[model samples]
Target: MNVIEMKTPKFLVGIETRTQNSLEIKGEGKIPALWNQFFNFFKIDKKISSDIYAIYSNYESDENGQYDYFIGYEIANPDKYLNGDSYVVKQIEVGTYSVISPINKISENVAYSTWQKIWRMNAKQLGGERLFHTDFEVYTNDKKNGQQSLVNIYLSLKK
Candidate 1:
């Protein structure tokens, strides 16, 4: 559980979709896979080739148990995302986010566990159900000692 607290001035939205209690979120675009393949082929640092993302879910809960619609985004290098021929790329509004550190790429268990910790510790301080705008897990293709090569978790906050 390698954890780091980061604040990005702005990050572009990547993907938007729905998710449940699943721990690991799978790859949905070719760019992400391509980036991973490129790094592995070159045996280089697990860095994203471009900015890539997938909106994971739309429904989020508030403090009062009310439902709010939100979108998710996966962050990656902008250059890699532009060069990939795998999926259609779209530009979205960028916003500040409280970013989490990379986790062990073990079945996305790191993502689920990080979220639980965030909800338990920071949820109260963040805001209401509207605060659940969206959450995303960023990944790069690298297997270090069978651990995750590149990845980050981001949560959209009310700012």
Candidate 2:
């Protein structure tokens, strides 16, 4: 494993909306189910792809649990609105991030371990107080195609 120090720029992504107020800083729970709930609440036709991209807070813990962060998913077209919706869509700005690339089955462990590695590297971590600036996981395979997947988990940092 390699720990790289990078001064990352800001980035944007498209996301599905969610009804529940619970924010998922870590990708611990079922993702597909969450997406289903988001789509159902928005009443938008489900997209064919099974991927979701959004901006979120980053947190690290000893027990490997959820973090206290507020996340707003990026919608494709902010101008377009669904019925019965009163929430406003906005763009989330993430400052810097530590991108961790790991293989499929070992992604979770790898992500946490990478945080430790970062801690050891003499750089400042998010430190659990303020919400993480950015966090994301990249899946490089399709479940339907039976292809091997590689997940790259990224943790955003403070400047």
Candidate 3:
């Protein structure tokens, strides 16, 4: 794990989808469907970045195991790409983040296991309070065929 500061001056423009479920339910099946739509849009639009991101924000949970989650990719330009319906823009605040690099490439299981390990770590050992406002996973575009890739998971930290 490493600590780094990132400046996100531009908007993250992409399609948005919501899921209401418990953490135990792992309703991440919607993610791949979103990605499929994104890629298809990318092929036709040719305006978005190939680098994908899965952003988890607006976290809310109740005693009955219900929560809300948003997932999308970073777009190159919002004004041109945003359709004002399914596609939307989110302005990310610049701040410090605790970055975790998974040992193996990011797959469904790897992402789940990595988050499990992160949740199990001691708070003091984590070096900062987890700011649940905006935690995200970055998937770069340089992945080689059949080769394992490293994923950087950025956890927002309280300033």
Task: Give the best candidate by TM-score.
Answer: 3
Model 2 lDDT per residue over 1-159, tens place:
223344433322233333212333344444446456555663333332444343344334312434422223434554554333444343435344556554445444564465455445444343322224446554456566576555565565445
- Tens digit of lDDT per residue, candidate 1, span 1-159? 222334343344232223343312334424344335434542212333543343333444542232221222333545555665442333333454556664445363554566566657554444322245555555555645654355566666655
- Model-by-model lDDT, in order? 0.43, 0.43, 0.64
lDDT accuracy of residue 17 in candidate 2: 33
TM-score of model 2 (CA atoms)? 0.43
**TM-score of each prediction:** 0.44, 0.43, 0.75
Candidate 2 — which residues are off by over 4 angstroms?
1-50, 58-76, 82-90, 104-131, 140-146
lDDT of candidate 2?
A: 0.43
What lDDT does model 3 reach? 0.64
Candidate 1: residue 15 lDDT (0-100): 27
Q: 27, model 3: CA deviation in Å?
A: 5.3
lDDT string, candidate 3, 39-134, tens digits: 687332543555556777675632133333344556556676556575667756689888887775666678767877887766565668777777
Model 1 lDDT-worst window of ten: 63-72
